[model samples]
Target: MKRPPYLKTSIGIGVLFIILMFLQSWLEKQPEALTASSEPETQTEATAVQPSERLVEDKRVYEGHNGTNLEHVYITIFDQSAVPENDITFYDLNESYKQYSNLDSGPKLDILFQTGTAKGPSDNGFISFGTDKPNATIELRGRSSRLEAQKSYKIRLQDNGGLWYGQSVINLNKHADDRTRVRNMLAFDYFRRIPDLISLRTNFVQLHVKDLTDPSSEGKFKSYGLYTHVEQLNEEALAARGLNPDGHLYKAENFEFYRYPDQLNHQNDPNYDKKKFEQVLKINGNENHDELLQMLDDINDLSKPFDEVFDTYFQEDNYLTWLAVNILFGNYDTMSTNYYLYSPLNSKKWYFIPWDFDKALGRDAERTDGLPQWQQGIQRYWGTVLHRRYLRDPENAAALTAKIEELSAIITEKTTKELIDSYYPVVKQLALQEPDLSYLGIEASEFDPAYRKLEQVTSRYKEQYMKSLEVPMPIFLHYERKNGRDVFTWEASHDLQNDKLSYEFQLSKTPGFESLIMQIKEQPDFTYNMAALPAGRYYWRVLVHDDKGHEQIPFDYYRDNAGIVYWGVQQIVVPGGSSS
Candidate 1:
């Protein structure tokens, strides 16, 4: 029965009271209240716009805002050489910047210095925030996530000392508006707290670009809006993490080790066409990555014991940790891409590094049936193979499940809700004041209420996530197609929470399931006579649902690449000759 309104109100009050008390207790224990600091440790500020000045000017101080305290970073980039020449600049910064979206080779751009504030010396004024080096070279970055309006960037800090955060390369992420901006930040933050994993450091930076050629300009930089600053994983990053700096570092764009040089994934050559491989991975220090290829060879080798293959080639904890985190965050997009693989030069063990999490926290805006979309399918070949091995060994499955349970507390409703409650007011206040917010589909006028609603919508995900019942995958028994009747059976799924479960079998003409031809409900197996069905190809899968109305991705779906993008789902062709 539904609780009465007064009782529900009382329960809500009790929850809020507890949260407020907890936050108060937690804050009392901390040396400082949670706040945004522009600088980490390097503390390089090249300009006069001091941190104190920006905080004071931008209204980020806790002084006036409603319980909001912030110190947002600002970057002023000037085209020093583009000095106006007879109403024409030597280089058109604005136009040249636009061409990069379409051009294979973007124009070279140089930065004289990067200026930003520090949490420590806000009073010291804005200093040149960059590597010990003086300046930088900037270019476009990203693969499928790239957009013309919101562009990601790669900054090569001059080798001498131009690194930001004491590194040579930096990735500036322009998370599209459709993506919750905090998704990437939250993932990185969570990874950092986990032991043994190499987590990327992230911060927000406000960028401004100027066009010197336009005589209409009073010398002032135009706001480029907000961006998430991520340190590029390179040799320097490895060194920082106490690993071999010269170790082979590969940031996956579309990596599938099993398909090397086979047309899709990059070729397994140390000398794989630099330009071609550049499209997929940043092949750092290992132009001849024979070790990576060997690892893949070992992975695909059926003769090798499954336990030995993973234990010898991969630091399983790192893989397991990365896998566990992604699964909880609902980032299925990461299995094939949005990750980094690195190996020490002397040691053959490879580690998985987390990357690209803007799609996390929730699957997407729509919580249809309260299930996160990110939890749907693992569509990468490497992931599928690993999962297949996991199935072959129950020990690995138990261990993985254990890891998920252990980490689940971190993503629990109470914890995430607490974070959302505390962070929203501060970050929302800061993001709203950002200039050029229009490009991100954020308008200056809508800052107050827009961010408020975003926080509300974003945090609702935790409710569903916390209530979600973690169900073991269904097992595929056997399939037989006799007389054009396809019969598939699967072991029933059991809910860890003891929630009742029902099965739904689906067959679609397309992998996207845009149009469903058949649905079988409350059954563990399916029998569909397709002889009379169309002669084209079809995809099939079974979804197990709980009494709570949560559904689990089929076992075969996890063991193989499936979906509209991957065609990994079970399949049958009419007038059948073969099926997967």
Candidate 2:
């Protein structure tokens, strides 16, 4: 067969895949960064042995700092390919830089770290290691913060004599949003806390990027700021979970059905063999994806009932729980691409692992319609067809809402609130780790995300944290023009636990209400006299407010400000008419 139709990938992605693999493998093998230069007693010594190579003691680990188990690993890269650092461009972050070579060997490395220290100087021993050749990629810009400078990074950590964690490859997520550096980490935390969910681990780290090859600043190093150490869901992860280590672990992209073996290539293999379809997954681990493909075929085959096929692969509760968590957290980013699917020998059963949750629990970014959500959809496969079948049914919809309510209870039982609050110091501490970060207002005191994050938790997440809460994110129901008047009505947003919220409404002539024609409070419906105004289209939306001007929540006694509890928007054409 010509590889399953469901697993569609680019016509030719092997070159890109090969380059990425080389970069990841080489990055992993390089030694971790050592202590800050200020800490002499905790210094990591580097000894040149042969061919500009040296042993770097990498003590990029810490036991307890910022109330989390994380390591401050430093990395320094040297371009030895005769091509100058200035010659490299930003495209190296994706497209292979002509100078990078996509080879795991060549560049000189110095990975060292101080022992028994999170920040301050220590008297303990140090460890180090080095690599002459490392596959590399540049850390590109605008993906996170404007203050950030271009840097280079790799996923693989070197085997430094049991000093570092067993996991090899990882993507260092530079806490980019600048709002809550821990947005992804917190989502991972919640996922791990939930029963039976497969969640990856993350920690904080400090980075140092410099040029040992550039004649201008060969020995000089610059701070790249703090980064979140995120573990990749690879074959190693499967082994740790007591599952078949040799099974397939597919990292989703564009929500496509990635069951074809032809779409991916193995990390070490350079030759693009069309016959070796089994190795097509980009994160393709252990060489077999047959089980996964079968499930996809079944899931997409409309001939069979959706329940029958869904049962063949996924556990209903897990699916529902994932849905509930995403909805509750407003993780609009929860698409197939941000998830990893694990399959054993036969595709009859699979496990779900959510990934890249930087968009979670940060704002009231909810969607009223569409798949993969407008905010999260990245022009890729939105999700499996089975997902639509489950949520599309009234019965299933009710069950999922109930599940969301149940999870909401657990979150409001002071768990999620505590989790969110306790992490404030950790995030703040991580941001404050490097003294140089503040000069650019990156982690400055005036730029803290604590208060705004609190507002999000209390306002956007208000209904979820409250007991037996209702008011389903107010939506625009109907609008009409009759009898020379414009009438607009919307679904009311109220809580069953306490009907103490009032409807705050605003209507404006423009899309963004720089000026408003009508501002009404405590009303779910409004009417405008068409005969009394100009003929044109107007925009409107509803905002919910508390009866007491502001409301105090149970968990942490968080008093929420006057905010839009629910959201809905619509436009109406006012047909002007003459009136007496």
How does residue 558 of candidate 2 score in lDDT? 12
Put down candidate 1 lDDT per residue, 382-499, tens digits, no spaces. Answer: 2355655643443454555566767765655555555556556545544565443455454566544543443344234333334442543444434557676666666555555667
Which residue runs of candidate 2 sit more than 4 Å off their true CA positions? Answer: 1-70, 79-152, 158-163, 216-221, 256-281, 363-384, 429-446, 449-580
* Residue 19 error, candidate 2, Å: 58
Per-candidate TM vs. native?
0.62, 0.56
User: Scored by CA lDDT, what does every candidate get?
Assistant: 0.53, 0.48
- Give the least accurate 10-residue stretch of model 2, judged by summed lDDT: 48-57
Roughly what TM-score does model 1 have, to 2 decimal places?
Answer: 0.62
Relative to the true structure, candidate 2 reaches a TM of: 0.56
* Clash tally for model 1: 16
lDDT accuracy of residue 267 in candidate 1: 54
Model 1, stretches more than 4 Å misplaced? 1-104, 116-134, 159-161, 178-180, 213-216, 256-271, 278-280, 366-383, 409-426, 434-580
Residue 372 of model 1, lDDT score: 27
